[model samples]
Target: MTTTLPHFEPFSPDALAHRGGALAEGPVALGSAGYTILNFELATTVLRDSRFQNAALKLMEDFGITDGPVHEFRAHSLLMAEGRRHLRLRTPLARFMGPATVENIRGILREIIQDLAAALDPSAPVDFHGGIDQRLPARVYCYLAGAPVEDAAKVARLSERTLSLLNRDPSLTPVIVAAYDELFAYLRDLVARKRAQGLGEDMLSFLIAQHDAGKLSEEELFNEAAAMLEASSVNTTHQTGLVVWTLLRDREVWQRLVEDPALIPAAMVEVLRLYPRPGVVSRIATEDVELNGTVIPAGSDVHVAVWSANRDPARFENPAEFVLERERNQPLTFSTGSHNCLGQGLAKVEMEEVVRYLVEHFPNTVVVEEGTDIGQAGGRWLVKSLTVDLKP
Candidate 1:
């Protein structure tokens, strides 16, 4: 027998913080949307368990994308894959996004940051979110996909529109559907052009090579490319902005980071823990599963409240404060287990490089609070506008 789970609305402002203060209430809660795992321990268990599959397909269906190319892609994409097939789909992409490849790309990241920074006027406050964070990830994606640099803006637009399904706005179904159609067409053209122009060492070229080698079918190849493109930008853009916004506002941390550039990575991780972009990782319980004292029925939706878990006192000491030197400071920002974010290494390195550039070039950068707007929606933190004064 199980008692009733308390009602909780995760998207409510300061909900995670409020829930953090009420941990003794239990680790799980029921909401209008679904069941939420509010503690670190249970959240990790649910994330790693194969019984809880990704809710992306369900999310699409809920938006009226029950059949067609977008539906088919989501149903068979890597996010919905399991076991060996998941590994098979993940391995090729992982080689390029893992630590070693990302490290080699660090120099390129620095160059890109420098170039973007060069466009800003140091004497005035600049729109950091618009000018830098929003633009960098798509440029990096272009480099990875072997797409033309001129296509960065278009790539950014496509990514933003396609992944906007996460916003949970039912009215945007048409936009999301059209975006996928455009994306599929763009990828088909890009792939055909790559084959015509001869293959290279870039990721898209490598995927094309794999297809030729009979490792991936035509549809699987397109699905993989679409997955990579859709995921490559929007979240990373907001996260990079969040990192910059958090670090610049904390003068003490900013000074320390400027003094010792070596602390950049740890400091970035601390920021990630506090302000994760993906606040909730939604999943569907494939079978009746008991978590804690509650037996979740089969096909129930489970929302892993990452923001709440990251701040749960049982997991992090001084759960609300920023502690840069905290040992084993691992947050579920990129998640865990086999299905964890494949591009996390690349995302982190991109942010670190951006921070590294600021610390090295403009040590006195500060957030222009009046011009900045940071807020949360659907339980996810997003940078609406971030202005910074780089007193170079």
Candidate 2:
């Protein structure tokens, strides 16, 4: 009763402080009508599972999942699907697309870095973060999935717009919906081409064969790839931006890495912990649950507040500090249990190699202010651009 949203966007540090450990505003009324947010006692019980009946994809309608033909097009991807449907696609997806594969292909990941490096104009102002954030994942998506490189810029643009609405404006659902559709259509073409010519080294080819192997279906193939790119690639892009920012500001962190290259892998996870790309977790409850005299009712929406929980004073001492050497310091940047991000390992590999290459080549990465402000808009904090003076 004491707080109001839009005034306080949940999962932010401010809201967590005011609401007393990230509790939802309660099963209170949304004014006038009988619209009420669900009463949630425990946040994880709902999202820590896909078993709850409330995990239904249709449940998106009651909450903030946007609606539109274009939006609906994206609804079938793995991010939106749960239960048996999710298992069907994700099972095979986990097989070939696992973390080991990403790490093993460090050579390709390095090549991707070299491509970004070549695009740099150290003298000319450029938002290194924005360019790489957009370029890396988009290129990764198209390349790994066997899509067209020509489409990377457009896919990157639409991907950024779609995810921007995730944390804030529910009203902008329409625009987000259109972006989803545009991205899907683009992926669909790539899937078809890969199926036709049989590009055997990449994921798309693997997927095409997997379907023929009874691991995936025609629908599963489409949904999985679209889901793969949209769900997996986007976060890597955001993390690329954030980790770069963290490195530039913390000169000591980079200097340490310069002294020891093997430490880059550990440093990557530290950056992931320090500044999570999503920066928040949102979930909706499926059943009544009781904890600490609070009852989170069935169907109530909840934001899991991983940002706060991972930084919980009880769980981690000095939760805000970036400590690369902290033992047992696994950040919840990727949620836990079943719904944990499937692409997390790939993200780590990509970020580690890129930062390693840059630090080795430049010795120092400093921010350039002019290139970073051009496209700053919305609830987006990932990177508009990052201009850093670097020695080549």
Candidate 3:
């Protein structure tokens, strides 16, 4: 049986969220190359089912991308692993990324965000995306990753180049490959520098200690560091910008947040539900299985339209509207099941603090000129360069 998948503008995240659910109404719809599951309930079932495993590692290998920072970052990261391999590394890393650890750093994060927010020029429009969003996450995570905070700008630049590789765009492969080489060298140097000093309390130090204890290999430690750099910085950066964009775009939303600070948390949840930076989470079927009356064959890739599922009317009331006090507002922004994002705790801490500070400090903040980078595939839903007037 053949299924005709409707054409979706792959570049626009908003369009995908608004149109994907309708286009993929059935249990599962065929995407450009694989099956696309847009139903919220079915996507949850697929996420938890062991038959559907993460395929990012296999996809990268299939692309003939051998070794480098990209390989270290994506091919061996927890997001790409399954079963025992995933557990082996994730167990230790999870401890470091838990709520307690995240809470411990809130004070530091607040200081960083507050300082950045203070630097925003009220007299003229400031490039909020580049000036604050891009820098804050990198600075915070670099400190956590045990890399010198001074090198955050460099790490961010390198990560941006290598991030294109994840989009799986053939035209950008060469540039992405070159970026991997540069990033690999930088990570290697950074790792070496960290090693020269004794283990500290930072995340990278903890991973290095694990390596020394024979739990992870030297290569694994470096790869972990590289992966942490990308995840901690890129995703959080875009999300922070998008959340602010959502708030300021709607005067009522922004005013509400300002008037009632308690609503900030719910506002954050709604923003994430409304606009997940990583629009889709995909998996591959390890064996043929029947789900919601649809037969998914073995070896078939399943693209879970996270953006669509979050806004599915079945799960969310008035899916298009952003309800600050939304009940049971569970969005798959951090994914679901065993492969759920490990850095989600950190992201929440970073976001809540940043948003709170922005709203409180810049009460009259308004978008001046805004644009998005929608060309890339994964983790590319950025407001890109948002010029905002931070005046009162």
Tell me the TM-score of each prediction against the true structure: 0.98, 0.82, 0.91
Better of 2 and 3 by lDDT: 3
How well is each residue in 172-223 modelled by candidate 1, as lDDT tens digits? 9999999999999999999999999999989999899989999998888999
Q: In model 2, what lDDT does residue 289 have?
A: 52
Residue 140 of model 2 has an lDDT of 75
lDDT string, candidate 3, 298-388, tens digits: 9988877788888888888899998878999999888888888888988887888877887777888887743434233552366656667
Candidate numbers sorted by TM-score from highest down: 1, 3, 2
Runs of candidate 2 exceeding 4 Å displacement:
1-47, 51-75, 80-84, 369-381
Off by over 4 Å in 1: 17-22
**What are the C-alpha RMSDs, in order, of all predicted structures?**
1.2, 4.9, 2.7
| Cα-based lDDT for every prediction | 0.91, 0.63, 0.77
Locate the minimum summed-lDDT window of 10 residues in model 2: 32-41
Off by over 4 Å in 3: 1-25, 66-74, 369-380
Candidate 2 structure lDDT? 0.63
Error of 1 at 169 (Å): 1.0
